[model samples]
Target: MKVSKLAVKILENESVVYYDPIYHGRTLKVIGIDDDPVEVMEYLLAQYKEKGYSIVVFDTSGHFPTGLFESVLRIEEGNPAGLDPLKMARMGIIKDPYSAVTIVQTIYELDSASTDKLYADFVTGKVNSIADAVKAKKNYSEIILEGYTDLDEMLFSGDPVRIPESGLIDLSGLNSVTLTGMAFLILAAAMEERRRVVYGLYDIAVLTFTGAGNAGLPLLTRPARRRVAILGTKYPLDQVLSIPGPTLLLYNDPDVQSAIYESQGVPAGLRAFIDKGEGAYIWRSPETINVEFGKVLKLQP
Candidate 1:
């Protein structure tokens, strides 16, 4: 079946509950079941936007398709606080005198034979090791950052918090709380900038550091034009209950289903594969339904 039809299915399920028994209809929450639900999600988002509705995705697993997004904000171990000077520069957080001093001191601190090569790399966005050393200068007795500029704190602070342009964001290596906070920061910035967004966060467990008090709960409670999808095998029911919209489950693992039932007293249907290749059976949430699996249409050159 076409993806639009799947969107119609989830949206059409009025039996889908959004409010918990304790909350008494004050909040919104619905459970959707499908194999390869990411594809279903992408299609659902397209359907919403086709009718002028805005949509947002919280890819908690970072497993969503990367090519579909216009821009990408990646937060992972690859670009840590002290090592991502290019990202800092691109965000306009580093500039002029402070930028110059940081680079100069970093260059001097490195072994002299490689200074010119490393400087060239930094200028070309090919390296951040120099910036890394400059950030950690306290550890090295020989390197001292001397000059102070108007943007001194920004350059020297070693905090790599940047608002990525609106697009696909990968928050891979950050702790859950940090991931949620950064997502809110970026999404808030996107709204202010009047930008359309489809953001993804991998490993959402980090967002629930404090059980029901998880920071992401409020994010779900807020009313917005975006369609946020929080994908994972296990999500605390309190956290899941706070989702003000539809919650899709791609895999029907017993642990996940049990967690949902135990935490929220809600029943998420069990998974059944009725057929191979064409589609599968996802029975139990509200009703039984057959779902289509997405395929790779072509390989990149």
Candidate 2:
């Protein structure tokens, strides 16, 4: 069944509950969205953590209170994978805003009934390959992100997160406004390849010299789950590693501005090189109004 977006305000006393027929009188808890919103997020995170319900926080407002997650993932500086609607539109691949991407393989007519059903799903999936077909068929990537056109431009591959053995990396040059994007990009991208990754959060900062109280984490973490990607930036924010999966922190060097935007300190060329995980140079954070055309997040740094 196609599920419309469900929003419940899970507060102390005012929330909704869902029941399961298979569980024979068991009910699923729902929360209210009335107050701080942090509590609702925490409750949801706790509920979904062990149950394997992946959560995606659409951070348009730029606040991620992901204290419940075990880890925070981060991506170094880079352009998106080059699979973007605007770029595709510029190339005359599409005529309208509602995007329709063709498969990398030659798509032919499938006359069989089974193939027709599969074709419908694959077309609707917004995936790139057979592995994704199988994964989408399995509902493996539970959290599918479909908002924020600004963030999707950096990817040539057109997927939200790419999973390599090293770790998770955000491929989009959009969403560069906050440091959390880099941290969570790594975490979310890493989780696609594996079950979970670890992150260091408030506790780590209190004990060690990492970060301080609730420094708005990236948007990749869900409640209760532990992951393995550790996050640290040259900026004077606190650091933490609460997730249980493989983790990596940012290089504690000078604050590079290009790392935070698509333009500014970045060189016009070598955009993909930065996306490939070589984020050591090309920054313009020192200047005000650093935004510009041509991928702001450089490839060199």
Candidate 3:
């Protein structure tokens, strides 16, 4: 038997489970007969346990497969529903809307259609079936934020990225931790489809270090579309350390010790919009993304 581990990333406890004989060395019978994506997901889990796979990760929403998988160990669901009801509702996966019976039926058609296609797959918490609702949170749109660098803007302009209405948005590769809250807030605005978001305290604290008084973040569950780009650390002479507002608006301060002829990447002229809160936002207008601090290089141009 080959063994594999599971990751419960969405679960608060962060559990890791391992099952003996992840695989039986030989192909034991494993089938995803269920149609509901969720049920099918559950069915897979049950099968994995019954047949004992060498490695398994239940790649669905927050659901533990039942029945056939009743005896299986070492399986888990990521994207656990949080305490918020809005997120749960968006998946159409409340106690009543989401059920195994409907989900299994749905997967049959989808699996058949997908059998011979070059496609990507996702799990959902849809009201009708399991597969329909997987990743209901991930509705992508062409979002253009203020990109501060050459290659960075290229990434944003070329591909469509997801903006979860809420959750641990990992902008770790894109910007400083200080802007985490702002990044989430901006995404929230886009999710809400607001032309402009009047960010409150909680929204502001989305990236504030622990102990930052941020109880006013608005939890809006609106449909979302778009892409993303955060600017600050990635740009030349960015004032992320000083003037506030996404840490990029602080450049050019008299106190900014940046060497001469440097804009500090802050685009000082943009400070008029910072609203004294040091929060900078860049989610308005056409597909053009610009900050005086950094010059935009055409992704293809």
Which candidate wins on lDDT? 1
* Per-residue lDDT over 145-248 for candidate 2, one digit per residue giving the tens place of the 0 to 100 score: 22223332233334433233322122122334332332333333323333333232221222222121122233223333233212222232223323222111
* Tens-place lDDT digits, model 1, residues 10-122: 32222321211121211223233332445544544454356554344445466666655566565553234332334444445444323433334332343444454444555
Question: What TM-score goes with each of the models?
Answer: 0.43, 0.25, 0.19
Clashes per model (N, Cα, C within 3 A): 11, 73, 44
**63-137 in candidate 3: lDDT tens per residue?**
322333222221111212121212322343223222222122121223433322212222232222222333223
- By lDDT, the better pick of 1 and 3 is 1
* Candidates 1 and 2, the one with greater lDDT: 1
Q: Cα deviation in Å at residue 38, candidate 2?
A: 4.1
In angstroms, the error of model 1 at 219 is: 4.0
Question: What TM-score should be assigned to candidate 2?
Answer: 0.25
Angstrom error at residue 80, model 1: 6.4
lDDT of each: 0.39, 0.29, 0.24
C-alpha lDDT (0 to 100) for residue 23 of candidate 1: 18
